[model samples]
Target chain A: MSRPSTRPGLPRRGVLRLAAAAVALPAAAVLAGCVPADHAVTDPGPGPGGAAEGVEGRVTDARGRPVAGAFVEARGTGPRPNPVPEIAVFTDGDGRYRWFLPAGSYAITVTAEALGRRTLAVTVPHGRAVRLDFVLG
Target chain B: MKPFHAIAMASVLALWAAGAAASDRAVEAGVRGPVPGPSAGEAATAAGMPYAGSDAVSETELAASGVTLGTAPVGPLPAEMGGSEVILNWDSRMVLKTTLYPNRAVGLITRNGAHHCTGWLISRNTVATAGHCVHSGRGGTWYDRRTMRFYPGRDGASSPYGSCGVSRMHSVTGWTVNGNRDYDYGAMRLDCLVGNTVGWFGMYSHTAPLNEPAIITGYPGDKPQTQWISSDKVRQALTRQVRYRMDTVGGNSGSPVWSDRGEALATSGAWGYAIHTYGNAGAQYNGGTRIVSAVLNNYINWINRP
Candidate 1:
């Protein structure tokens, strides 16, 4: 992302001159685009919460065994004005939670109040089903 | 006078003239507020926003005072995920790292100017960032010099067009005054319209599952003037909270904990929650500060209201 500039007194001409100067310095562009974008998992099918579109996952302990009654959540992110909704649910006796979510980018967090908490941030594309598993200590 | 001295004098005069003209334009544009840049002492006033004693003012009074104390805004996702999902999409060999911080990093600048950090603009003028970035001293008072204005997409001292002031500031009731890590989020009311800039990110109302993939973004001091993004492997999930590993350092404290679509899920807080390490080695860990419906509603009401 580009940081905004706050220099007080540059006219249009001055701005052009600065732009020219900046171009002369190749490192400026490199520095300008320094931060890398996030690479997250994208949803390939219907998002959770949609009819026949949801996330199914199991919460387990470090031993790779199922842990019952884990809390599961589905979240999504988007531009301003409108954004995806965040949803939450609890696991069944089989330690599974099926969350229905709108199609978009989401960050998921799961917690077993009695046991512990864990989080996963991902994107749920449209018409796709994503599965996540949590292992607590 | 020597020739070099004469040249230097001319240059200084030209620079002064340019600065004066710019100041005049800013005033005409209504960007200039009554108070000049806030001093360090003034930034400390935010610490005062949250009262410590029982005799302190009520939330109503604080709201009247223009101090917005509540959660961030949450909204629905876009119909289409069309924008660039990745920052550096061309690079395929790069691998994102996950880290955590024991102490949250907050960006502080003078009141008038913008403070640069990876923060989320939850409202038109309200922003959510780490409390440590805004406060200092034993009581964690807001620091003025460091409390510069905020420019979401800032490039060093330049803020192009986007600029906002700290009209009001709010944080979790207890964390505001006591420096509690569990609730390390802080919100600021802006003087300008954030919508004109990079725009604000929406909050999530529903809960998310643990052990899912996540991406983190922020501007690191080591690489100032630029933003960094990283993806972490989902480790586990506990009750009410989730833990994950990401590569983060000091200056990234105020960075937004965002979902894949750039929506902010939580503000980076202390090292960790419960037994997990908030900061292990050099990585930072974050717990989900659920943006449920009620919390999101409160945040929206606060920012949307006059």
Candidate 2:
């Protein structure tokens, strides 16, 4: 494989140029082992204003079973005073809960009246479906 | 204008230095000695399946490539750039600049000539980037992968080590089903043990103040190149969106927004300016979904569980 280069301090544009060259130049010329998988493809999604949707998934226990009636809450990172609102839901029979929100930072909390609580933090981008599964003790 | 001029000059200098130092520290830290790698949950291992989609990759792939995810320790940036800016205000724990990764590594999967997105390791097998990088919403569908690979230590288009396939993936319900930007975060369970060469980052259990200086870092495109902005100031919004004065570009999506202390508070995604559509613009505005303590706690519990 081609050895990773560690030359720092290259200008931002310079780095970009180098990257372009790296991509265009023959992989065989630089390094032998490191090869770009022919499987790799690039599909830049639609530009801004595409208003991507959010993600949704279910939370379950250790036995591959859903945690019924568990309380599910959602929180996010933003500025203060107007920080992303924390939304909550209860798991249905299938241990599933869903919420629609804007694209941003987020954390999910699962709590049961008897089982305490657990939280998982994640980042959701525009037009994506992020799946977070919680396994309660 | 004397006092105003002095303040403006100070701010400008600070910003410049912060930007420079942020990148410097990230590169420096990446080269440092061994850091902790991601651990597998006993329950996950025993069950032979990860909670989310950690099973996307196999052990053979991870071993062949030596790919791992997580954070490295980054030193402080120059004093200017407001490295001490506070972004989240919780209880006693003040999330400072010393704790977060200003830059992040994102890996895009090319299968059947389509590129799906995922993030790189900062501290543990824990990788933080954009939620959209992995899953998507088109035709009322979610991009669920049965198999994929990750290149954590990729510097440019080359993987210094080998590449590993994903074992599992995780995201919040609101983010997946509701398109809620507020709760846009995800985690993955790797199939193999990421050695010390790759590490994970720390999280702020509490909160900090608003309008604190913060740094944002990430790989804009599939290339392993990264960028940093130090002197940027962010105003915490009541809506959980921390608005900041920083110039970001495309391919920067899924980057991490970190406190001066190196604690990741958010990840980059959507941009506020119209130039975002063209993928070329300077002095443009980009936003990241923040990592609140409540959500982080959930992730911790899931990852650490036996």
Candidate 3:
């Protein structure tokens, strides 16, 4: 038997169910290509709120291991009047790459010599750091 | 007069005529506004609109297509190394004064309403840039003109030369069709002739441009909408690419890889040799798509277009 819930608005089992749902929502979003598993609230780092937005992410291989030296190319595919910039950057030794981009939609492609390539579309909100991770096939 | 003396005089006149013709071509390429004297010979010939200058795959191409693809092997690249370093404010220089000649012509390119890249004016209306800046390639479509804009000499919030919407975009089959990295160059035709005011960069094909000073001025991703510059010498001049150790980051694609012809940035002497396209990635050098004769000819053709 579980102990009584500590001064809350639900039974112990109900609280557990709600907690499970909370934990599963992010994973479901990840599978749905909404955001990464860790995306909770967008982080707009310390600044005077500059016009440019940011995209920061890590690249990993199929086995979930960080893959360094991968080329991540982002092409702007827009909303109208304002399009995103075209950018191509490589992942660091820790398989991380980040860039500041103006707000807009982007078609991002990741290519690795050994593991191959993949493309995904993402929209960066204004003045926020959007996390976009990749898992190569 | 002796027959030898007559022949010598004729030969000297012939050499002068050839030199004059070459000079005219340089002027036509928009090297120095317009020479002080007569106009350059008739506009660049249109006979070579879509010439594939050379056949070489970029190091990135190996990954794009796992099948080791290329008509010829690319020449030696710079030493393999790490990615670009994060620069500190003291170590970096930002071009605050954007009204200067070549600086004014080098503009910031934006796709849709958000994406950014660097482009330099090559003609009254044509802006040269990286092919990837216009098209995704190897599984991507061309960027729509409705979403593109160019701001010459844009420093932060100031677009000193105003802005021009894209009328047309241009790229070669190697990039648009084949997705070849060595062919990663393209251009945009602006709706207005802004280059006339901001000035455009002159282009030339150097059979050997190695060791010539390479000054790349463009907007870097780290510093949004701000233009910065880096300098170095051409470390490796391949068949269709030029590698340099110049510091650069994302968003510098299509920046002019140019030389001031050792004339102290004379308005008449600067010429672009390549369109900066790639960062070092893991390689020891950053590189650009070299402007070969065929590429230069194609640019002339594009420039002359309506």
Candidate 4:
């Protein structure tokens, strides 16, 4: 199936452009805060109207194959509030999923039948893309 | 010059007066009574079945024992101007007495043996929950009914009312197709009439359901199979959603955001105002899809579906 916009209200082009830019930049320069992109910011502070940051990730099994239809549940681990919906997103044919959420800490859990579940805690920075991948055995 | 200013102020006063009048009309027109579905006694009598199976409480015994409903009275609606803004209060507790009224109505939902979400009974064989609980939105398809189960009055490791398998699940096109959060409510048809013994919550709607006591009872994933509860006032009531400061986690998605009216037979025992959905929003208030006419009507139809 064609991958739909993982984050509601954000165009697919914006996510693709961010992904592409992340690839082109040298890791050392990007880490040193030299790369300038609309969604690449170091500060995790709140933006205007509590701007949403992007969270895109992939899920795979222990065998390193993409695990399609794995349920990815995201919950805000809040000291400050994060507004992610309770609706769990699933991986596409490529085992990739993306979500835009208000910048805050989140506990993302990936689960599928027989493969078990794995949870990762990540703090989403405002106006940036955070990658969170999972491997279920 | 004084006359000109007076004319301007008068024009402003006239507009304000008109607005206030409309606001009053809206509040008055918004008041709706609860739909108290069959009580445990009534349901048992109608079905010709024994009441209170598996540690459940019988309505007759509960009434005779003088147990309180523990619901708030029907309070007056606040002024329409900024009425939705309520004081944020976050406090929740574990409910040890899950077999009582209103508590027994709530249920734990399991999708393929894993604790997924919460739901509540609206009829003998019908339940109301979040749309996402029944069908994953947008990129996801509807969940298979065979893999889903509902357990009423389920304490940790002790299911007082047993469990029922889903016969069918129902959701709106807005959620199933468009993935709209405004229409994030759904219902399920249970294979058995578990609600007849465990009871159900009546739904209440008001045009301006602001400042009303909001209670959420559900099994949070953090707590495993146990049920927890939180209570506060409706902070904000939009056209299709209501916001509150009640503490909730992921599995509390389909929990009923209801206000108890304390009268089971005389009026509704409790009235569900919204179906809890998403987590906290920009303003830090968690919310759900408010039960407007369209939503309530859809639930009523689903409750009666074969």
Best by lDDT: 4
Compose the digit string of candidate 4's lDDT tens values, residues A1-137: 87665766577766765665454343333333421111100111222222235578999988899997777777778666566665435677888876554467888888877798999999888566699999999
> Model 4: what is its DockQ?
0.07
Error of 2 at B69 (Å): 13
What is the docking quality class of candidate 4?
A: incorrect
Per-candidate TM equals 0.39, 0.42, 0.55, 0.58
Write model 2 residue lDDT over B1-306, tens digit each, in one string: 554344445555544533332221111121212222235543322111111112234456555544542233322322122234333222111112212222223233322222233354433344444444444422223334334455543334444334555555555444544444554555554444442233334443224436655455433322223222323555543343454544433334454454433321232211111001111111233355554444444444445533
* Model 3 lDDT on a 0 to 1 scale: 0.63
Q: Give the per-residue lDDT digits (tens) of candidate 3, residues B1-306.
A: 754444445545445533322332432343333222112431243121111111232335323322222122211211111124436322336775666666777888876444368998776567889877876543345666676788877778777656788877877656654556677778888776555444566787777988987878888865658888777888888888888886676778889888766544432434788889876522457788888766776576667765
Could you give candidate 4's per-residue lDDT for residues B175-273 as a string of tens digits?
A: 754556787788888877666555676664556878887888887665657888888888888888899886676678899887654433223355677
Evaluated at residue A34, the lDDT of candidate 4 is 24
Per-prediction interface RMSD in Å? 20.5, 21.0, 26.4, 19.9
Better of 2 and 3 by lDDT: 3
Per-residue C-alpha lDDT of model 1 across residues A46-71, encoded as one tens digit per residue: 22222233466788888887886565
Model 4 regions lying over 4 Å from their true place: A1-82, A87-132, A135-137, B1-89, B262-267
Over the stretch A1-137, how does candidate 3's per-residue lDDT look in tens digits?
Answer: 98666866557766765666565554444443422111111112222322335577999987899988777776556434222223646687788876654466777778888899989888888657688999997
Reported per model, the fraction of native interface contacts reproduced equals 0.00, 0.01, 0.07, 0.15
Candidate 2 per-residue C-alpha lDDT over A71-132 given as tens digits, one digit per residue, 9 for 90 to 100: 55555544421122222245667887654444667666777666678998766766565777
Model 4 pairs in collision: B84-B235
* DockQ for all candidate structures vs. native: 0.01, 0.02, 0.03, 0.07
